[model samples]
Target: MREIDRLEDELSPLPESITRIRKLISTLELCHHKAERWVTNIIEAIGEGDTAKGLGTRTAGELHPAERDWRDACVALSAWCAGQPAASVEIKIGGRSASCLLSKLGERSALKEWQVQRLIERIREFIGWPRSMHHGDSVYVFMEECGADFEPPGDAECPEHYREHEEFWKQTMQTRIHDTVNGEAADFSLAVAIDVMFPCNWNFVGNLDIVLGAIGGELYAAQPLTVCARNICHVPIRERMQTVCRTLQCSLQNQRSENDVDSTLLELLGDVTAPQRWLVASLDKTIRLQLRL
Candidate 1:
C-alpha cells in the first residue's frame, strides 16, 4: 500500500509535465509557421520591386541577415530536440507511467517568440517598411499593390456591357477579403457582386484567382465586342469559359461541395443589377445548358 501511494505521488506530476510539453510543442509549431510565412513574404516583396534598396538583388544562396538569424535559431532548436531522449518509462508505486521526454525544450537555446519577432522587425526595417501589427499585414499590402497592375488597360474602349458595371469593378478593388479554408489561407480583393452571390460562407472561398477567373470569363462572354479592346479576340469565349471552369473544378474538386458551387451560380442568376445580372444569368444558363448537352 505504501509503495502504491509513492507511485501515485510520482505519477501525479507526470501529467502536468506532459501537458506543459504539449503546449510548448504547439507554440513552437506556430512560431515555425510564422517564420516561414515571413520569409515567403519577403521574397515575394523583393521580386515585385517593392524594396527600396538593392537588398532584393541577393540570390537564394545569399539570405538577408534577418533570415540567417531565423535559420540559425531553427537549426539550434532542432539540434537540441534531436539530442533529447525519445521517451522515458518508469515503474512506480502507482503502476507504470510513460512520458515523452524533451531536454532544454524551453531553455535559452530554443527559438523563442521574442527572437522571431525581433528578426521579423529587422527584416521590415531593411525593406524601409514599418513593423506591421499583424504578421500577414505586409504580405497583404504587397499583394494589393501588385494586383493593381493586373487590371487590363484600355477600359474606355470596352462595350456598354462592360463599361456600365464600373461599380462592380470598384467594389472588387475596395473589398479586402481574408479567410483560411482547407488548411490554406487566402487573402485578396473581391468584387461586391461576388460577395453577394457567394452562397456559402464567403470565408470558405479559399482561392480568389479561381473565382475571379470564372467571373472574368463570364464577363468576357457577355460583351464579345470587348475582345478587341482587351486584346483577347483570338480566344473564343466558350473556350475561355471552359478553361476557367476546368481549372476551378479541379481546384475545388476535393475541397468544396457541389451544392456550394451550384448555389453560388444560382445566386449569381437571382439577384443583381441590370447589366451585371444579365451577365451572370448568361453565364449560369450557358453552363447548365452545356452540362445537359
Candidate 2:
C-alpha cells in the first residue's frame, strides 16, 4: 500500500479519536491564526517606529502615522482571519517555556517543552525569549548570551552606552538566533520573523535590510504547530528561566506578556541592584503584553 494508505489504515479504526483530534486541531489552527495576527500587528508597530524616527522621532506610546498604519493593518487582517482555525505548540525557546501557534507545519511534530529545549540546546541558539525563561505562570522572557565581562555601553545615569555596544549586541543576537534555528526551518520561520519585526538591535547583527529580509524567511517558512499546550504546561519555571535575566532588555520589550512583567517585578524585589528600586515606579501600560481571546 502507499504510505498515505498505510497510515489511513492504521488510523481508520480510530475514527472517533481522529474526530476528537481533528476538533482539537481546529482549535489549534485558530490559535495559530491569532498568533499570526498578533505578530503582524507587532511588526507593523515596529515599522511605524522606524518610519517615525525618519520623519522625526516620537516617544514610545505616542502614535505616529507609520504606527497607525501598522496597527490598522493588523486590526484589519486580524478581523479577516477571525474564526479561522490554526495550529499551536508549546515549545521551549531561549530559556522559557511558552506556546506558539502557527498557520502551518510541514512534517515534523510540534515539540514538547523538553524536546523543544533539547533541540534548542543542540543548535546553540538564542532568541528574544530565552529558553525556560519564565517569571510566573505566564510570563516568559530571555536575553542575549553576552559574556561575564560584557559591560553594557551607556552613561552611568543616562548611558550613551547604547551607541557604543550596538554593533556587538546585534552581531551576538544574530548568531544566537541563527545558530539555533538553522536546521528547523519552520520553527526558525516563526522566530526569525518575530525577531526582525521587533528589530532587537541588542541581538541582531548586519544591516537593517538584512534584518528586514529575515521576515520574508519566516513568512515563507511558516508551518503548522503540532505540539499541544498541555504538553508544555508542567515544565518548571526556574529551569525555564535558567538563562533569563532579572531585567527584560531591549529586543524583548515587544514580546512581554502581562504575566511576564509581573514576574519580572517580583524578581526585582529580591535583586539588590540599584536599578531594582527604580523598577517599582517604572510600571507602564506599554510594558504589558495583553492577551486576546
Candidate 3:
C-alpha cells in the first residue's frame, strides 16, 4: 500500500527474489518517470543544442543517470516477461533509431578488428557497465536522426590543431544515436523516437547523454570516449578487450573484472589517431608494469 506502511507492515524481511522484484518494479517506474520528464523537458524547450530549430531539440543541462538501472531492469523484466510467461514483441524501431561510423565507412573502414575495437571503445565511453538490459531488458534508449548524420568532436590533442577543428566539431557532434541499437540508415531523415526492447540477443545499455546533439546537446558530448574512436557494446568489455589486446598486441586484461571499464581509464588505450594509438601503447606499458607488481 503506502511506502511507509509497507516498511512498517513488514513482519520479516522479504525473500531476496521478492526484494529484487520490488526493486525491478521501482526501477521500471523510475525509467518511465524519467523518460516522461525527459520528454517534457524537450517539449518545453523546443530549441536547445545544435538543433535544426525544433528538430534535435534535446537540452544540454539535464542530468542523465547512467542507463544501468534501465539495463538491469530490462534484463530482469525480459526474463519475467518470458518463460514463466512471455514478452510478445509489442513494438520495435527497425532502424534509423541508431548511428554507426563503420557502417558509414563500408569500404574505407580499416581492419575488421579495428572497426570492432573502435565500436567497443565507443561503448565503454558512453555505456558505463556491462550486461545491460541483457535479454529481457526494458529500458528505452532513444535516437535523434538529425537528418543524414553527425559524429562526436575530433578532440585533436595539439593546442593549435584542437583550435583548428573546434568549430567543425561542434557542428558534427549533435544527433546522438543509440550506438548499439541497429537503427535504420536513412536516405532521408526521420523524426526522433525511442524503443527499449525486442526479442534480440541483447540490447545496448549506455548511450548516455553523450550520444545525442550540438545545439541542445549534453555537456558530456564535448568529451571523447575511447570506444567512440570514433562509436557501443553488448557482447562485453572484458571479452572484447581480450580480443583487442591480441589485435592491438597490448596487455589490457583485468580491466575492472569483466565490467564495462570506466571511460576515463579507456582513454589511455584509445586508438583515435596514430598518436593516440602510440599513447595507448605507452600507457599500456606503464599499466603492465603496475599489473606485474
Candidate 4:
C-alpha cells in the first residue's frame, strides 16, 4: 500500500490532465450525439423506405455531408482522448520547450499530424500559454488558407464618395459640438457623439464604455453603451478609421484634458497625442483653441 501511494504521488498531475481531456471528450461526444440525432431525424423525415422521385432513393447506409464531417471530427477527437500518454513529454509553447502532460498527449494521440498540431494549439490556448511567433504564423497561415476577409481598405481603392461622406460626418459633428457648447443639449455624452459621427463602425457603439474607461475621466456614466473596448488599442486605426476619427474629434470638441486623451489614445495609437495634434492642426483655429490644441 505504501508503494502504491508512492506511485500515486508521482502521478499526482496526471489526474488533472486526464480530467481536462475527459471534459473535452465529453463536449465532443455531446456534439457528435446531437449531430447524429439531427441526421437521424432528417433521414426519418425523408422516409427511409419511400421511393419518392423528388425525395430521391434513401440509401440504408448513407450519411449527410455535415453528418460525415461531424463524425470524422468526433472520431479524431475520440482517438486523441483515448491515446493520452501516462507520462509527461516535451512540448514547445511560445517558442520555449517544456515537459507537460498535454505535450505527452500531443505526442501519443492517434490523430493525424495536422490534427495533432491543431489540438496542441487549442490546448496551449486553454492553458493560457504565452503567444509566440509560431502562434502568429499559424494564425496568419490559417486565415490565409480560410480566405479571411480582413484586408485593409487602401487609399487608392477607396470610393471617391468616401471623402464626401467623411466630410458630411465631420460637419455634422461640428454642428453637434456647437450645439453642446451653446447649451442646446447638456446631456450629450462623448459616447453618443462618437456613435453619431461614426455610424458605420460597429465597435464604437458596442465598446463605448470601454473606450471611455480607457480615456479615464468622469465619463464612467457612459458604461451602458454596448461592447467592451478594453484592448481596442491593439486594433488597427486603418481598419476602423471612422470611429478613431470620431473619437479624436469628440475628445477635441469636448475640451477633454490632453492627459486623459493621451492615456487612452496612446493604447490605440502608440503615440497618443500625434493623431489629436494632427486633427487639431487640420481643423479651424477656433476649434483648435477650444480644445487647447
**Candidate 1: tens digits of C-alpha lDDT, residues 61-151:** 5644444433333333233344433133221111211121111123422222222232233234333344342445433111122222233
lDDT of 1: 0.30
lDDT of 3 by residue, 1-293 (tens): 24334442452354443333233223221112242332222212211211122212448433344344333333332332233222322322222222221122223212322222223333333333353434333222222222212321234222342244444322333334332222333211111211122111122222222222211223223333212111122222324334333333321332433344334334333333332233233323322232221
| Residue-by-residue lDDT tens digits, candidate 2, 1-293 | 14324444555564443333233222222112133322223223232221111112336357433333233323322322342222333332222222222222122332212222222322222221223223242221222222222222222121242244444334333431131222343222222223223211211112122222232233232222222121121222322222232223322343344443335433323432222122211211112211110
Q: Candidate 3: deviation at residue 286, Å?
A: 47
- State which candidate, 1 or 2, has the greater lDDT: 1
User: How does candidate 3 fare on TM-score?
Assistant: 0.20
- The number of clashing residue pairs in model 1 is 2
Candidate models: Cα lDDT each: 0.30, 0.26, 0.28, 0.30
Measured over all alpha carbons after superposition, the RMSD of each candidate to the real structure, in angstroms, is 28.3, 25.7, 25.0, 30.5
- Model 3, 122: alpha-carbon shift in Å? 2.6
Kindly give the stretch of ten consecutive residues in candidate 1 with the minimal lDDT sum: 221-230
**TM-score for all predictions?**
0.16, 0.18, 0.20, 0.19
Show model 2 residue runs off by greater than 4 Å.
1-62, 84-188, 199-293
